[model samples]
Target: MNRELPVFIRSLPLVLAGWVFAPLIPAHATELPLLFSDGAVLQRDQPLPVWGWAKPGSQITVTFDGGTAKTHASSSGEWRVELPVHAAGGPYELSVAERGGETLRVRDVLVGDVWLASGQSNMEFPVAKAQNARAEIARAGDAGIRHFKVPRSWSDKPEPRLAGGYWRAASPGNAGDFSAVGYFFARELRTRDSRVPIGIVDSTWGGSAIEAWMSAGMLGADATVAAEKIRAKGAAAAQAATQTRARIAAWNTAPPSPEAWAAAALEESGWAGISVPAQWETQGYAGMDGVAWYRKSFELSAPETKGELTLGLGQIDDSDRVWVNGQPVGGMDASWNVPRVYRVPAAALRVGRNTIAVQVTDLGAGGGMAGSAEQLYLRAAGGPLRSLAGEWKFRTADVRLSSTQDDINQVDTALYNAMIRPLQPYALRGTIWYQGEANAYPGAAFRYRDLFASMIRGWRADWSAPQLPFLWVQLAGFHSGGDTAGESPWAVLRESQSAALALPATAQALAIDIGESNDIHPRNKQEVGRRLALAARAVAYGESLVHSGPVFRAATFDDTKARITFDLQHSALAVRGGGRAVHGFELSGADGHFHPAQALIDGGAVVVSSEAVVQPQALRYAWNDDPKQADLINRDGLPASPFRAERTRATLPQQTKQETR
Candidate 1:
């Protein structure tokens, strides 16, 4: 989104928590934070906080619409005043003035329902890469919808203000850079009620873990020591980041030419040998970031060269630019997880030797071409696929360590300190989250049950909105390999995410039916946004509609069968895809070994039974990493969330006389 900071902001001297100096204000000058600048959106129907820096003991006055507030600067030259609550309406001007000094005026300020959209890559995915993006971008000229993107930063302690950012109203040009999920969420809200302006505050980073977003205090016990270690590492990261930025800036001036690198005759004996379809981190280049070039050669038969050849490069981590036989075939700067399938024209193909070059840039976290080896191949006409799964010559063109290292944003409390803490207490109607993949490992996935709810409650406490609505996207399907009946980390994470629903005013949006098996970041975010909007309507707006599909209620066992009941709220149970028999049901006896079970729809319940099991003790639905056949949905077409239930002992009896009869 061209989030480059201004020279003044960039040159600010780094301090503890990377704080911008409050003592730098001129004696007669009153300077408000960047958040109070032009085009800012203040949360409506809440007490608005207007703050700034003035000379010590100086009287400050803030005026917006017909409301006025007065306060005196503290000994530290910091001052704040709260304006009266406002309704959802504005095009108003906000003025901050020193009692007898200069005044700063902000124009076109909006008062609306501001939603904090925070999470990882899926939430950070841009509209430019979403499905039907061209049409969506063309129609995104909504002045009523605005976005404020928080610049990526990290600190060990809370920072009082953002480094720099500005609000941009939705436009054809700007909307393409906006978070697709956030944009569509707001778009759906506008469809329901256009009376209030909608503002999306995007605070996100790709590949960030859940721990990175929480405050140290929120993590509980022994966190003091952990926070101390994180603080020390944060200092080291800042130093490393400074050096890395300088090197990157120097490299940007006159970086190595891609044409030379991609040239068919380019010398490559010095390049290192690396395996294809693997992240560079798994190779010898662990904890490395920045641009790298990969080159390989393949021999094509005469017939194979006649037709347009398709080159599949699996999926590059952050971005990639590809060239085949010294000609640019295709490239994309975003949607890192989407496979790169470039159509190689026959003209660019050769009967024999052909050189294919790919330049991959990893901005943060894991990098390089991932996905299965089968996905990396070449095909033409009716010919069998020629695998590109062997060794390839690789060379690092540039490197940045800040993003790949432990000292950066991945640490606990890092993002909370820099990105979220600064914006706290800024009234918001609610928050929407999309994360968990980073923490979805075997042992870590279970911890999310408590950690997630703690984070949610902590955020509510931070804002002093006890019943603030919180919604999150459940972990979607992706093939992370595990038996259907065995423990699946993704399924475990989904269960952990569902656990958060027990908290007050919370809802979950299911994406199990919409995720791609090969891609971690799915492109069908429109449906995700639609589901989240439905959740918002039910949780935030007091709507009585069925926002979710049938939730698992209880299970009862009768020697050979298990009857599963669901808490269907204003909806009837039905299997989607026009099939009568339900899928994704499993049964297990006292041995605790699960077997595939046939299921049938029985009015308000699903009866499951497996001939392989004599007595069912437990049952599970959609209990796989990728539940490809799970089709249970409400009449509203919303898919039911994954769940497991055990048979209540009291519901079963030892061969009763009636049963014997």
Candidate 2:
């Protein structure tokens, strides 16, 4: 057998060797994974691992940047070669060649810091939707910054390769689809070090939970069991999804004639009662994906009907077609977070008993009218706004027989199996995460403490980087402000996120001040990116600058006052608005009931006192779902994280009997 023979000639020996050896020679041609395609960015200053597929036992060689490495393909036809470490510069080419087989070459490859950005909707939010997106996109022409977005997928087990993806450089056309947080993070990094190329790998899914990104080994026994149960129904779930999509298609192409369901004259005896301004999943329609109908009736005076009116439907998930008294008013699709407002013509309204019906189609996850009570209203000319927040007649137009399509991304390890597992051991400078909104449910929020920490540790283990720097954005403020502060699930979830800092090289960026009360997805991603870069500078780059605001250190309780101290280094505690008084502080006495407290900065410490409490035993700051007025920041202008502290009663300074009196 000649050594330089063609692939077919070389395979003749294997074919004659036996059927057992024939399986080793891959049926397909030699190829590289999507990550190693053109325009890819490899992590610099580390051993570069290049991999691809070829005939089993085939000799493989990888060449890059004046260096070469050789290896042999495994029994599974997989081959990997490690090239010598390179510095942070390249627009070079990487080539993989198999003896007697095809040779693959990737162009425009760079060696630099590669950061993985992963999480839920916030991380997936595109640059086009961010604040000042148009200006940012126009200025996004940096060739040194690149992005690789992992396509959404799920599997029952670990996948050997990604479903599909491509590395795109930062430009006006490509940057709009880039993750806003990721784009800004990479942009800031390149600004700091222009000579070093920066790459961001974005792997995210909206409305996904933290557990969905973790492997079964990283999850608890109960969670693993639950995920297994879901996995058992994989085939049925797929069938249901296919059937449901067909049904939705049939309904969309051939809808009911005249849409009689939207008419005010339609009988409501068969419809079920459902509340507006909320997702249908939270109501009785959990785990349903497809179309649903909601109809609301309201009365109006003759003068109100005569004037042109505005119908505010708040936000609808996925898509919606709205009608006023059987007359189509408006429709929108794709933007689930945007509020929906329709104009009702004077002729479309009646003197009384007018009906507003909406047909909502949710491709997956949450559905129906999802908004705050204040966002649902009807405003008539020269009149006060009327509330449309009460119960409405609801009916299922179409739904998936199986709940799999709606809940697959939420299953434990499902996303990890497809989106994360295949990227293992890829050299990364660090990771940035923005999640927890999905895990803010009552029990899940509290359990996030252990789960989050374990997930970070598991990822580090997967990459063999014991000290991998992990940074995350704390859960931002949400919900309408009121007395809903005492026990907030969002606040608890934030605490869980902060608790993960107990791990080494871990940092958190506080976003409690930047969140929108009505919208879960905030557009102030610029600030979020800036804060994350600051953390990266301190943790990843070993910078001495202060990256975080004041953190609570200790607290002392005297007769009528509770003095609180903070761990402030290279910076001093200050009120955000230049006010001498500090807000967002609460005090509790022996009864364990918290009341608003007045806080005054006394030198380096804050002295808190409340007339409502005699002897303060506990203190809480920014402890609400929406801490709108929590205005405490360090001299660096970063907001302090929300916290709760209990007074050490044993360490309290004994007061004289008269002082107690």
Candidate 3:
């Protein structure tokens, strides 16, 4: 046994002695598990459910708010009793008891609004490093804002209750660990309605696909998903088993031969030159996969230093193995999603010329060394270190096998089974989502809107919260170049998102202007949260905020100009930053060809005209991948949603009726 085992054994007699001296402890026929933990905020105006497992036939009594309710445990050891709905007031205690004498008491319980916040990585992203993190963290000291994070687990079947979770107040100490977007949204809600305590049940998983949050029954119910599941199960099992074997083989494989590697290492003067931080695949090594070695030599005047040394290698596509002077130092796996921070020990350094070598492996798209612009330095005991963010020597190893056949679809499928099903029974105020970047590839995103709406409707049906407030984030601008427009799948996906807003109580956050061209996951999550909160206030709380940008209401075309009208609240149309020329408007004629058109905001509407297209059949605004010049903003400063207008399809009968009219 470990050292603590003896101490625990030694304390048993003392514990018994104390128990004997104290008043006799009551014994119960059945023990019951605790329901919501201490400080839990039960939903107001609804019968609060207090449940646990107890012995069969044992009577369980729950007392709260001057009322008592009793229920008997079933033969299966499950027991549930609901406390009568209490008014929205609390700072009280709740007690649950069995006739035989077991009792559980929770103190400081509150009755208020409770909501479940769940999604993939973006929802799971914490507040520590998000945009305006410091200010937000400092402002999260409100006691009314509470959060509970459900521990991650995967289940083949739905669970009645989560394994473990508890409520915690938002404070600087704990706020850093809370979901940034969720926290901000809740903060906004709490600030708007200070009397109502807001409880956020955070259940999210990073890098999880949408399918994982769907139920197995739901998946089986859909023909497309059913076939996809059948294909996915076999592929998933094979991939898991293969990965297991690969990990084992990696552990068992002998270390690379240092002597052979040294012999293979390029001579100092004869090394090939390459730019640092550029993708090797894009830089004349297209289709190349697996480990490619890069080396750079720098001189150090001092023999030894005390401070830390940091190496900045922009970002690597997949995995990388790095070394300093042929000594294995540090590395990273997965992808360039996370920045690499290596701390060099003083002993690892030597005076004069030092060779820094890196072996990069690209498992998939956009692989190789990246992120070279950040701080990469060799710091001394009392001084700053030298920077290493420039050119480096390079060479390719053996060609890598392409594992593109491995199905990435299994992630969503598995997540649906594990995380989403358990929360089906729990009532929620609404759902806020921030995803779709993962499916933004060509031909893959055409059905995303349908899939997204189906998932929303499916969730509403399952949870019985029909017409529940469902808000989502539109894909922000990303990647270099403007080619991701004009038949771009992302544009199509955005259109789909716009179409979803036609559903009841649904809204979309326009985020094109706030996105970074270099990073798909933008750091400006504050705006993301504020926008989501605005939608929730408008749709869920029935607040009169301008929760949406200008949605395309309708348009009438003349010989030379198209007159467009939109729904605006509290203000008229205004360009971003008060610009004179409204941007991102295009006019297309019957030939399906489009050209830039001059646009002007004319009080709650936009007028578009162009000499290039004398008769405009359709007009599109902010319809490209990166519309940096898109100046269509509401007076409230929210950017107008991206959209493309085409004639709606009418059936022959409807067309005949229109002709008759």
Regions of candidate 1 where Cα sits further than 4 Å from its true position: 1-29, 221-224, 235-260, 269-291, 296-356, 361-364, 369-392, 395-407, 482-485, 649-661
C-alpha TM-score for every candidate: 0.83, 0.82, 0.71
Order of quality (lDDT): 1, 2, 3
Instruction: Count clashes in each candidate, considering only residues at least 3 apart in sequence or on different chains.
Output: 0, 0, 14
Q: Can you write out model 1's per-residue Cα lDDT over 1-661, one digit (the tens) per residue?
A: 1111011111222222332223354564677776777888888888887787788899888889978899999998888888888988789999988877888999998888899999887888888778999999999998889988887777656778776678999999899888889999999998888878898999987667888898878887356665686667756656655554443342332125888889888888767788988987666554456677899998988988888989999878767999999999999774456778899999998878999999887765567887789889988767888899979988777664433243355678878877898886677989999998777766677777888999999999998999999999997888766433456767778888888888999999999999988667778989999999999999999999998988887788999998888888889888998756999998989998899999998998889999999999888889877898899998999888888877765221122232122
Residue 543, candidate 1: Cα error in Å is 1.9
Ranked candidates (TM-score, high to low): 1, 2, 3
Please provide, for model 3 over 508-564, each residue's C-alpha lDDT reduced to its tens digit, 9 standing for 90 to 100. Answer: 887888987655556677788789889988898888889877777777787888878
Give lDDT tens digits, candidate 2, residues 362-481.
755667888789889999866899999989887766554322344566778888877888787678999999988877866677778889999999999998999989999998787733
Q: Every model's Cα RMSD, please?
A: 6.7, 10.2, 12.0
User: So what's the TM-score on candidate 3?
Assistant: 0.71
lDDT (Cα, 0-100) at 108 in candidate 2: 100
